[model samples]
Target chain A: MQSENLISPGFADPVFQSQAAFRALLTALSEPGLIQQVAPGFAAPEGLEPATAIALLTLADYETPIWLPAALRDGPAGAWLRFHCGAALVEEPAQASFAVIDGAAEAPLLADFNPGTDQFPDRSTTVLVQCAGLAGGDIVTLSGPGIAGSRDIAPIGLRPGFWAEFSANAELYPLGVDLILSQGEAVLGLPRSTQIVEVR
Target chain B: MTIHQSIPGEDTKPAYNYAYLDEQTKRMIRRALLKAVAVPGYQVPFGSREMPLARGWGTGGIQITAAIIGPDDKLKVIDQGADDTTNAVSIRRFFERTADATTTEMTEDATIIQTRHRIPEAPLTSGQIMVYQVPQPEPLRKLEPRELETRKMHAWAEYGLMQVKLYENIARFGEVTTTYDYPVSVNGRYVMAPSPIPKFDNPKMHMSPSLQLFGAGREKRIYAVPPHTSVRSLDFEDHPFRIQSWAEPCGLCGAKDSYLDEVVTDDQGGRMFVCSDSHYCETRREQGHRGTMLADASASGLVEAKS
Candidate 1:
């Protein structure tokens, strides 16, 4: 057997692990900028964090096509996700229901992904960006639904124009892509309803 | 313990998937839930599954609970704010068997509380999630029967018809007669139906610290209100939104702040009001809170000595 063929195992108990992971993700999204950790009982493949792997396994399926950046697409992470989640790998971000971007690398413009339509905003893509860490970066203020008055988040290793692209995406209110930042085992959510103030 | 309908629980644990739902179905609902949370008050259409229960009886809430619940979670189910009601107990029992999960009647102890037609009297914290069984997810559907037009209304934030509906109610009944399922604008964007929960519970959702999820199985839609989001009930400037209040306190727990239901005690047209939230009422009674009816019962020798 090839070295890559022996991919790391997914959740031990698919029922509990996925349910628990989904709850954690829900908590993160429901309270924007709140970091939540879920142990999906699986090791991460190359170039992907454990949180990313847990998210893909819990959410992605054949129906939800996923678009990965070049590094993840070419690496073992792609095969791992394809094997574990059975999610269709798409080259174009527009065709993807979910997309994963490496924050350390050059990320594509937020416009590249689907912003859904004015009628059905739920069709918008959910972008998951793998970051360096959940903290120790430029602090940004978030306000909107899900947040109380305001929330401050500082996730490391997002590209320079990332916030600008996110701001442009926010301009499209109920039609923007939701972002999730995963670092190590911590995941912070920034849904489209959340407004990004500045990286101060 | 009585079975109202055929809620045949599959005793064979190994045969069925966890929580009586397959992983694929869970993931599908999970995706819809994420979208629902992302866009507050927007009814996101999803693939509604056929559950063991009937479609009209909280299948959407059950599916949402099944999708989100884990073994470690303490599930709580309520119908009309009563924990011991047929619908509430059955659903709670179903989850207990299928998920092998512990169930709690107390609001504070539960991680996820599934409800039909009422929000708990107790304040919900940020850690807890409230799943509402919504028969109708679209607030504009009743006024405008056309689906496309309603979608356009939501898309354009055109809620003139809703105001007209309330206005018509005022013109006919001297007040907005919509006692339950009152419409509210979530985050100032989309108007959402907060299930059939009495307008008394409507104020509980505004800027609430707890996450709220609404599911309609027949409508095949899911919507959400994230914690601390603005949920403003629709009403005219003169006709402000007001909750139902009673002059008398509860007969069971002496609760004046809780929503009350009138119960007729005699055929002579005599009635007494009691707290609708069974768990809250029971806890209060246990704490030696006496009420008008409790004193009467004690005087009549109907009260238990222990209580």
Candidate 2:
């Protein structure tokens, strides 16, 4: 299907791909820190991964503004998203309702994104980051509400320098940004509520 | 005005993003959904915005659906499950036009089912998720209107008030007057409103394989029943949980094990019983449950003539 023409009339009727995306998101959100696959046959943005694009499509709306990393900010990818999804591009990360980082390596530390205010922790930003791998490796011990005691998740790629930043971010408690790390088709969640520690 | 004046093109610029929500709104909803799922029947308070649709008309279901829908998935929207009824048609048509996902009438075929007033009679599988449109999310809202008070009540595990209300209902009507949206406690912690589905559908919510999500747009809350979660209707042991019973079969499907919709057919109030789950009814009919009209027609060999 032609890229421009494909989305215009909306996905050919009856399957309801958007609704499926919505349900996947709820399941992902419900079981926080769990990996859920995005619907098949969805077109991923040039630099953005499928998981990131799926999250964007399901949650992004007219009222929210999106911030794209410098790499994909000015191109056909940007125009295509604007034309189809109607998300606005914001210069600052704090102003962005949703921020898409092509790769977590370049993604700003947890503190750079909005952690929200004392009264309303839910006002925080949700960062969708792209990763090279999603599973299988040294496990990070995570403890939180959804987790039984300490659940092991595949270690996420991050700069060693960012540890101090995240440690400080964790201190903020109720006010912090949530994250979704995507690798091609696979998507894993890391809501702010989760306490993460690297286990040797 | 010429056709060009009305049509929106690349030059005109379409309003709204790919999924109709901006990122910030998506994050807000995502956070609420997480809390809803985490608490497991606790009504999470959210700042619900007005959708393009009306307040009471499936906005809660629509918001929850919007928060969860991804780009590559199938969606089914049903109001009583006909898929052609005015509201169902409008909602299915809404997602079809905006989100551009595939829509279907079949329950087994859909991955996400956004429903109102009823749940499908067919048992849902683990693969499927049900989003219910809730007018109110709090089971205690009618009993107590204040949010601060309810939070305190939940914190203290205080449900005596809800039990007392049910007890009063027993005293007044000799049975619970609540025919639909009957309150139920989840995992001994939170009391939740099971959308507005009639009491017959309440049992279906208990320990079902499918995940159940409830959203109230006007009230701005979200809640859920995870796969195989214990959900109990608030009642005395002697009172017991009961499903609405009818002596007659569905007028259209001739099925007995489904929720029946009461219909008034005559000035004398003669009634016709029919399946409230329109899709289930249609499926049974397709499988050959011929009701009064079809049965009479078939018995006379009029089916061939009609065809």
Top-DockQ candidate index: 1
| Residue B273 error, candidate 1, Å | 0.9
Local distance difference test, per candidate? 0.89, 0.70
Top-scoring candidate (lDDT): 1
Candidate 2 lDDT, A1-200, residue by residue in tens:
66653422223321245445555665665455577787666667577676677667656666568888776777655665676567898878998767877443645666778876643455567777776676775566766544444667673565554435545665665456767778766777666555676654
Q: Compared with the true structure, what per-residue lDDT tens digits does model 1 show for residues B211-274? A: 8999999999999999999999999999999899999999988999999999999999999999
Clash count in backbone of candidate 2: 30
In model 1, which runs have C-alpha deviations exceeding 4 angstroms? B1-14, B295-304
Q: Which ten residues in a row have the lowest lDDT in candidate 2 chain B?
A: B1-10
lDDT of 2 at A19: 45
As for candidate 1, its clashing pairs are: none
Across residues B50-85, which tens digit of lDDT does each residue of candidate 2 receive? 788899998888877766665555787778645678
lDDT of 2 at B166: 90
DockQ values per model:
0.64, 0.15
